[model samples]
Target: MSGDGVFSSGVLSCLAALQRLMDGNPTVAQHVGLHRAKITAGIVSVEAGFDRGYLKKSRPAHLPILAKIEAARRSSVSSSISSTSSDVKRLKGKLRLLEDELATVLTQRDKVLTQNIQLWERVRELESAHRNSNAPELTTLT
Candidate 1:
């Protein structure tokens, strides 16, 4: 489609994408499925009108409706992307909090283990001292 926005598969996608970006409407972006920069080159051909390009010319009348459709599509798409991004950010924050908690727990475990080891060593030393001290001396019988 030319300025009118009537197009088949490839042309329609290109046009639709351009329509989305230039329009910056979420509804169109959703339908087009990409960002604005990506659509720019494709729109170059469209800016010239379909008559200048390989694709057949879309009538001028269709442009306004197509633009409207693209606008709505882009608007919805933008909305979805914005919401999804916000969700991802929230999830990332939660993940960071969990990781911090995990680290704290691991450090506590290490400290407890060290304390246990020290206690066990002290007990062994005490038991050995008691055995040596309590043992009776033996004299050899001739």
Candidate 2:
């Protein structure tokens, strides 16, 4: 096939079908028997009304289409990686905030516990002093 005539009706349709698949078009997804994440040359060809063997033959005419498909696949993979990285960063930030909050709550709890202990000690001492004062005076009969 001549370079100018490389994009026949079948090739054009295949490219269109690939774009639709990548864009998550539900109808195309159903026709191709695969979703965007699972797009392959065979599925694209089939969706374009070509047999699976059309792309498998690796004709020079198919180079451009194959290149486009590979590029799309690489783009999708990189985007997925970047999105996952962003998600990890967001989760790490949330975890740090929660850790800081937990530390603050623990400090407040320790302070409250110490105060309670001091108050209980003071109460016990006051009770002892009151008991001693109320005791009968010692008898000093000469």
Candidate 3:
């Protein structure tokens, strides 16, 4: 019974170490942990009725699967971030173009306002000339 307890503790320690190694990938780590639990259960069954050779043969298959799963997740995240970056750059370009168009419109508006002021000044001068021409003249009897 003591030997069995020691063996189980050793297996738990190994599982904890593997879990730590997979900290960067939580989802994959969870899957790996579940797989390890299943493997541990199978080892118990083997100790009860099967051989050690079977355990040795089955051990190497799942590590490669975990690595592949982690790689696919990394690629997916990489593509998403890159696409978002491109979208941000495109939006910034559009904003700059809008700013430039606003400046051009403001310049045109200033020119129109200047021309309107000049026209108003000309109208005022014409009114003043007409008023002077129509003034009554006083003549003295001689």
TM-score of 1: 0.46
Among these predicted structures, which one has the highest TM-score? 2
Mark the 10 consecutive residues where model 3 has the least summed lDDT.
Answer: 36-45
* Candidate 3 lDDT tens digits, 83-128: 7899999999999999999999999999999999999999899778
lDDT of 3 at 135: 63
Tens-digit per-residue lDDT, 58-134, candidate 1: 64534554454456557767977998999999999999999999999999999999999999999999878877996
**Model 3 CA deviation exceeding 4 Å by range:** 1-70, 135-142
Q: How should the candidates be ordered by TM-score, best one leading?
A: 2, 1, 3
Residue 92 lDDT in candidate 3: 97
lDDT of each: 0.59, 0.77, 0.52
Alpha-carbon lDDT of model 1? 0.59
RMSD of 1: 9.5
- Sort by lDDT, best first: 2, 1, 3
Query: How far in Å is the alpha carbon of 76 misplaced in model 2?
Result: 1.1
Best by lDDT: 2
The residue ranges of model 1 lying beyond 4 angstroms of the native Cα positions read: 1-57, 135-142
